[model samples]
Target: PVAAASIGQVYKAVLRADASPTGERMTVAVKCQRPNILETVTLDLLTIRGVVDFFCTVPGEGNKKLRQDAQGLLAVLDLAATRFLEELDYLQEAANGARFEREMNAVPVMRDVVKVPSVLLDYSSRYVITQEWVEGVKLTDLEGDPKYANEEGAALRADVVRKLLNAYMVQFLETGFLHADPHPGNFLIQPDGRLCIMDYGMMTEILPDQRLAFVEYMAHLTAGQYSKTLDDLVTLGFVSEELAKDPAKREVVGPVLAQTLSALYAEGGGLDKKVEILDQQAQSRIGEIGDKLEELSKEYPITLPPYFILILRAFGTLEGLGLSTNSDFAILEECFPYIARRLLSDDSPRMRSALRTFIYGGGDRLNVAKVEDLTRGFGSFTNAMEAERKVAVTGEGSLAVRSSATPSGQLDAATKELLELMFAPEGNYVQELIIEEAVRAVDSLSRDALVQVWQRLPGAPPGAL
Candidate 1:
């Protein structure tokens, strides 16, 4: 079979003539597991558990208590990890794909904005999955392309981001089930400009209560309701009450939380700020806090429900993809509305109590006006596609030669800076820095210089050089 992914392989095949649904020849993409993937997954889980367990037990302030709490917490995590890993089963994947299609069909907006591959359930077997072949280019390839460098391009990119975020929010809050992976490679942009999303081996479902808690947490963050946000986080098991009550412990986490909230409000910022806060520097200082928490968890460790971890991982993947496309894409802004709605519409006693505290305690109100403004912005962005223009396909074997209006403007200064930073002798922090730099360099330098520089960069893909 042809390889399609890191953990699985895909093959292009024709359905048996007699078995054709339409009685016509059809191509299908078949995905199957790579040898030893199960083993690799098992080992990975073990490693994660061991590392988290050991870290929880490390001696430090409150570390002993955290260790005690972590023991039971670890057991719960292990159980969830096992369940998630079991989703790798071909049968489970098929069922999930069917459910996803049903969910997608229920949402009218999703029909236009997102593409869910048509699964060939009858053709699937114990170790294999068959789905319709989707023809398109990966979004990863479009990043920094001159074809997508203009105002229209930026708007299209932004629209796709918004649509994806909206879809996730609705799925998590309304349906409680979601596609857990949003990586670029799993996303395809058709020539006709439709967004095709494939690969559903890792779908997850959230419990209703947990989903409600998550929504409230999101609402609190978006509304700038810090104390409520903290309470919601604790309710969701992302943090513990002890941490919330202890000023010393809170002191350790307080600035990070403030920075995270501030970054959310900053123009052109998003989840990247949270990631930056979690980087090497923060990790070093906060490692002890985490250890202490884990130790404390051994006795009173907060057990995060399975769905919450899945949501966290899903968001993490989405944020990574956003950064990969453009360092400036803000995910939280796209996600705020559904969260706000969840909080405001909630009728549960916990939610009511939280809302009472939020309102009476002078918590910031959900900015309905801001949500309306953002929704308008998103609509404008989507409806504002650039006028159709042709580009010349250069070199021999070129199918056509055409010229349209030359695209205007140079690359942004920040883009240029990022490009230059990639060439630094010291290590660059982000992967693909060198590749991005090469693309920027080509835009800035002479053809010969561009070619020379491109040749020097290792792993410059075919069209890139």
Candidate 2:
């Protein structure tokens, strides 16, 4: 038994002869919460917003970015809240363990290779989990294990890694739920070639749409449509409306993301000998993207949904752990089987629809109505430009006046009033749009007096910039 986390620690133990649930003494691992952790954790959860703010100040590239993107910050806090609450419930964790085991065992490819320790139901409680002590080798230390150093053992290790990745991919691509934390400590290699996955305290469940969006994201990348991939990313909550709609900022983001994705999957750093190569190469690449994203985050409202971030965390953790094994793990290849399986099945209507839209490009089938609308917009723009030229040449104010119901003086006064109301902390305006438009006018139009007032004010809307 070996591990420690924010909530608990694991220890090697043996059941007493008379206390055994099986009526025989046996080795077990006791997972118990830290002393008085619950009350403190609950207290901390109470101040979780401050916890989010604290993370924003934790000397990282995304600190300023996190502070600026309020929605993204909220998403982070939400994920943290869910994780902490789930981890605090030992009973919920026990249930998650059983569910995970069933999910794995239900899939034929994973049934034999994937394993979870049996819970000693009689010994478990609200603060403790007693499970069979598993004897398995650590992944990093597997290189030195005499029994697994040979070619045969290497194949077995590779197979195990494949199954592990596929199992998790299924959890992500098909099931919409996954083990949120899968760091090296939670995994082990059994003597008889089984992959033992432990710990179930943190489970993340995503919506079906999010799962389909994830698949769409992958399909775009596979199809070599980086721009479309980035577009899909915006829809999936990685890029925000502000960022996607801004050409200059999108230029800053697009290449960084494309390069990062390309480099991550590029030949040298998967789950093989190239793990070292990728580990070295990707560090700087990812850091560069993080820096750019963080800096841009101040000016553009960028956000990553919590589920997407959690999925990314799982993959990153697996990638880091796979690096230690010195084997090229084909994580992408493993995903193909299941994704293909889902697409071909009649039972999965969602997958079939997603396949048509994503894989076969069917959902985007040409529409006469959309074309007509585009044509109409073009005609309107053309007519408006000609009308503008005529008005400019004729020196006419009547046409422009007809477009506005409010007089210029009244509109200006109203805008000024709105701007003032927005900056006043106790103003309490419910129209979010008013503050946004007023701030945009004041900030962009260089209304010097309004600018002075805004400068004097302490706060603005989240995406005012």
Candidate 3:
């Protein structure tokens, strides 16, 4: 009753069995895949990819981007075709659902935040999967409601988002099996406030070794160790070993990655307009980056390993979800805890290398970005709030109020609440000063205080204290 997608339609039905836990008849979600969906998807991909190939072949102004990424386009379509075809297998989905149920069981603490419906194996077929029906408020509905837009409301949404993301970290970094598709309709807010996850048609399995490398790559990135991140990326196969070994082969990928990811996770940078800006950059920065890529590929390849594509897609999708929830959820920042836990809690050469890659002790410097972010957020809030007040006093809607903002306004709302917490009875602010600036978090508070006030501040992830 809730959803119909390209692949399937879900209907509410009552399943009957003598050994039913609740009764002889129990409500279940019956997901029936469209007949010959695989064929349909194949034909669609063929049509789209064919057109894309045509553009890549005929050199033109609008086709420049496609031409540049032509080979990659073909590879991605090929890879996607395989994955999309797999999504049509109801039996595989049933198994994926079962696996997720097992994962949920392993971490009982996670029950508060997320859940998986019970699958009825006997009722499942190659084209149809049946599982226990779950009733709850859709995640989008919770965010759409006017009441959940304030500081407290944002905090609640942020908590749920964090829990959901952390669970994903465990899946990708620890369990090695992830629900690759987490589009909005796949989630629900249970009556008791837990997140219910449904639809496991698309899942990614990260090989054990690949998972470790991913963790190392993330750790280095989080610590602002760009040089180390480059090495990790090379070792992870994003770059060819030939390039890593050849100094003559110029590569500016490290700086690009560092700047890109840093900007992405920077305060006030989550979701919101950043995504559009980044997409625009991809199209606009071609002249700047295309030459470097071409030169770099001469000595080495720039191929992304098969599994990495799925992982990256999931990451991007997560950002979209963050945008919807109006929460500042940083993917790399969130990865820190899970990666640290693994390295510190385990013993191995890989773990040692990962720990080593995590750099510490940088020269003290003001994070101008963080300050700029605070200023901008403050400005937006002041402007928006002032507009609202003007409307109330003048009895005229001359200016529009941004009360329904997605990320930009919501971030400021959360920041205002945190500033209240950051201040003390002593009448001074506990501003985030130099993040990793070696400021002692001791009795000497103010003189040592560094403002997290900007996006430039870096240290342990928030709440690590």
Best by TM-score: 3
Worst 10 residues of 1 by lDDT: 386-395
Residues 26-117, model 3: lDDT tens digits: 98888888777777778898998898777678767776556757767777777777887778888988998999888866753354345699
Which whole-number lDDT from 0 to 100 does residue 348 have in model 1?
Answer: 61
The best candidate by lDDT is 3
279: Cα error in model 2, Å: 16
Query: For model 2, how does the per-residue alpha-carbon lDDT over 1-465 read when each residue is reduced to its tens digit?
Result: 477777788998888889987778889999998889888877877786776666655666656555555546767777777787788888888888878777766764455556778777677788998888888776656655697777666755554454467668777866666987887667777655456788888888878877777776765564445666777887787777767888877777776676656555644455444455446544776556667777886665545667666777887776655554544444444354445444333234544444444433444343345323323332332232233333334545221111212345553322343355446565432233245456766766676666667666787544343
Instruction: Measure candidate 2: CA RMSD.
Output: 25.0
TM-score of 2: 0.59
TM-score pick, better of 1 and 3: 3
Better of 1 and 2 by TM-score: 1
lDDT of each: 0.61, 0.62, 0.64
> What TM-scores do the predictions have?
0.63, 0.59, 0.67
